[model samples]
Target chain A: MEEKDLVILCIKGNRSAQSELVGSFAPRLLSLIKRYQPKSLSPEDILQEVFIEIFRDLKAYNPEKGVLYTWMKTIAIRLILKTRRLDQSWLKDKTVPIEYSDAIPDLDQILNKMNTDDIMKLIIALPDGYREVFNLVAVEGCSHEECASLLQIAVGTSRSTLSRARQMLKEQYAQMKIY
Target chain B: MENNRKDWRDRLDQNESPMDMGMFWNSLESKIPVQNPGKKKRRFLFWLLFLLIGSGFIGTIIIFNKPKGKIAGQTEQQKNAGVTEARESSLSPIETQHAADEIPTSDATAVISQNQSSSAATAAGDSVHKALTKYQSENISSVTKTANTSDKKTGNNSNDTQIEETASSGNASPIKEVVSENKQDQVFGIENQNIEKNAMSTAHELAQNSMAAMEYLPTLSGELYRELNWNMGYVPTFDHAPKLNQEKSGWQYWMDLSYGIGMAQHAFKTSDPLTQSYLGNRSKYESTLESRLAVWENRLIHPSGFYVSSGLRYQTHITRFDWSKEEVKIEWKLADGFVQDAQGNQIAIRDSAWQQYREMREIRQHNTISSLDIPLNVGYIIRKKQFSIEIAAGVTANISQYTSGKQLNFQEQPVKWNATEELTYKKSNTGFGASAMFRASWYPTEYLGVFIQPSFHTDFSNRMNSGAGYEHKIDFVNIQAGVAFLLFREGR
Candidate 1:
């Protein structure tokens, strides 16, 4: 059955369709959560919470705004952020300045050398504040202001954090080449 | 650099992770709570609504049925009165014959006085005596002879002779004309004297026969008088006779106050399936209490009991409804705009984030409609002595209706499902309606009465023009007990 039909059946309390709906979305949601969530939280636990929320609020979903996957992805990101406590007030004024480098690596060489998992690992290894700002602003296509509001930090702080995160990635990439 | 960032973001979006979905589904399904779908509450509300409508109809039926038995009782009472009159007439002739036999002994006067006194104790009997007195005054000779013979047999002959002498002295000129005619008869011969004696004997026989007929004559005349009085629309007063002017048809005015309970019914036609479903599932109609005060004037069109009445009434009707539960979901599509932060920095929101919020709410509503009604009714009145009953049917023109109620406003964007909006029914203005009333009244005085009226009214046009995908019309049955004070009436 189609995703929308499965969603409607799940809302009507059909058990088999509910299981199918959960099966269809759980792996994709777990993958999305794995990218954003802390390593301390279990992938299964985060996926469990996202699926529960999806079934609970299935009736609230409108296909007009976006597709079902995009909607569920948004919910998964919110749950991951909330579970990790990344959007809390503790990130206030935590931005660190990065020294500006004269010779930056070519983006094409960096892209060709690293796999997607390696790039994801590089993002996950950043500090909580830098990683949140970097994910929201660079990966999620959010503006600096949106990233600032989402992280509860100043726009200038968000801008500096992303710059510092890029510098750190460049330093790591150069080191990797030397090895 | 911006293009490089965009390319990296696109790359991140394409990334996916590999996981075992079957194992994850088993764990996730175990944690979700199961919901029980039951319609117990909805079923209870439906039964309650059904009972309310049923009771309203039953009560109206009972009220209409009551008047029939009461009318039958009134007819029975009239029949009993007629029987009593017939009995009196049947027994009266025997009493009159006995009085005639005692006339020579002067016991007839005593007997007649005794009979009149006995009959005077009852209202019907008193009317009978009055009718006899009127008849006696018109034809005096038979009654006068009987009176004279009774006096002579009682040894009051000297008193009778004195009465005659006094009468002759007062009418000496007529006595002289009678004496001259007698002398002319004497000069004519013995034959003329024989003719005079024969005429005297005939007059004596006629007087005897008239005395015998007088018994039944009084009873017939008495009954005729009562019939005439009733036909002339005369309501006999305890203090005196009904006046001549009161017999004519005229205007009667009174004021009435009433209270009752009624129910509301709704009919809907909509092209929107959602609206139709919501209305079908959620709308519960309930009974409402009402009150009315009015002043009416009836023009008695015929003495045979037809009248046309018109009144101005102010009435208030309340209708209660429970709308079905609805789940509302609103999706906000944010546009890119600059909003000043707490620090007064303009932040551009480039990403259009979709925020989905849902609410479940049930609407309970009370609609009160107050209106001024002008009713034009034509009715037939059955008037009996101090009581009257009128059954009237008419059209009532609603001059103005002011409706105040809680309504759900779904058309406004950014819907607040929990908040109720006050709606005024603008189309509730002048609408024509039909009404029927059964009024039973008792006149305690000449110009004052108390009445119990069971009335029903239904709108010819819809009472609500909400344009909210539903049309509503209301019909109500009201059992109103009220007092009527006649402001002006033709005196009788």
Candidate 2:
């Protein structure tokens, strides 16, 4: 009956309604995939694979989380991460950690405390171990113990690395202020 | 520093956050067009329809094919089977039905005693016991009344039975008088002539009309049979084996192979230093032995007339340990002694050298026991169709003390400990004992029936003489639930 209502029913094993659901959301999901990986795979190719995966595991998705577009977006992100991790050559050479955060704050607080332009530069400059722990613990607000377990490091190392990242940030902030 | 770090942490969080979806999806509406929406609604209704139809079909089949005998109204034939053949045979149509409806003791007794004399001669021993028990129980107080009448008048009691000739009067007095007459005849031997005369008449009845006379036959029309049973249960009392009984109901003949997995602890003194040393300086080590059996006929109680099953039972005990030693090793560094080494020359040594070396020798030991038992039992069913309850009891002979398999493993290999040493086994003079089992099954149809049996009995083997090998007695009490088919049921 309704656009959003139609996609929800299609995802719940209503076969005839699925084409409508895919046509509406497939392009946006593909574009989101393009942001994470630009040229390795086509948006159309990734989108098709994502729809197949979604259809196969439709019952597993929790509807209460968000609307159809947001739900499709989350599935695309998980599949992208999975594809990259499983490609041994890419995994070995890339050595990069995915980043995500749960909090949204005022632009003033971010800029005054650790400005976005400077913060991005600092993150790009930090060493692999330091950057990974910094992103997970500081940016993502994960516990130091959780970061250690996920990164396969000692809790003490996680704490010290996070502390060092903050120290470096403060030094940069101080230097920028002087300049 | 803490506030600055918290602020920096909060600033880092803003970069990795997800987009606000409420506004994102709304903005993208014009970019994506709607797809076909009609066909999807039709499919949902189909699934609902299929589930409803499938469940209804299954419910109908179940309703039509309900376990027929599990819940059926007791018919006249089924209820009449257990009405005591002796009572049913003596009473005419009106009397039998009346007595069966109401268990009037006097009328029922008259009907039972009328046919009791003929049945008694051919009945199995247990049937006789059951009849005696039922008679004693049902008419104990009434029998006391007869005791005052002097056990002399045997046939005169028929006058009391004739008081109400009509069967519908619910007259139990006639049945009671008949039983009393038989009792009188037996106690005073006054009517011994009449009983002999009836026996002759039966012989004549057999000659004149064999088939008609055979109509309520007392003797079991089947052959003698044997059975062996194996049973196991936890023995709460130390004085005896646990009670393991079979559930009685219907033709119950089971050939079971049972094993008793038991653990027993014993404390005994040992001079072996290995066990003594490891036993925390204790003089004796309390060791436990586990027992097991290979094969045993747990139950072989054959109801009279057609079954035979015998098998061997091998039993043993096994023990397990984490750390054990056969001998203890101790290194003693003794003080120098005034003794010659190789050559007989006096040597100057410290005063402590004269101290003698001392070591305690110990050896670890374990014990295991095993036995082989073979029992042969035989029985026969009495009063075929006339008796609803098939009562059987018999004796079994311990045919073989040694079975085919290895008896027990003590250390590593099986040892014939009992065989190696000369044993004066207290051989029993043919072990004799009895068991009683009652089976009653009501078959409403040719293929199915409801069988119920609540039975209990015990077995007795001669007291063995290892001194420790006392009599092996096993008792069984069980209730079995199963469906049986009459391969060939004899019908009149």
Instruction: State the C-alpha lDDT per candidate.
Output: 0.53, 0.36
lDDT comparing candidate 1 with the true structure: 0.53
Interface DockQ per candidate: 0.10, 0.03
* Model 2 alpha-carbon miss at residue B89, Å: 14
List runs of model 2 lying over 4 Å from the truth: A1-56, A65-129, A148-154, A168-179, B1-177, B180-492
| TM-score of B-chain for each predicted structure, in order | 0.48, 0.25
Q: Model 1, A1-179: lDDT tens per residue?
A: 87778878887889899987776666666656656753334566557766766665576677776788877777666555544443355355444455343224465356545777667666665556667766776677678776665555677777777777777667655655622
Which candidate comes out best when scored by DockQ?
1
Error of 2 at A6 (Å): 6.0
What tens-digit string does per-residue lDDT give for candidate 2 at B337-403?
2333343232434332121111122223333434444534443333222223333344444343321
Each prediction's TM-score versus the true structure? 0.40, 0.30
lDDT, candidate 1, at B318: 69
For model 1, report DockQ: 0.10
* Prediction RMSDs, each to the true structure: 20.1, 28.3
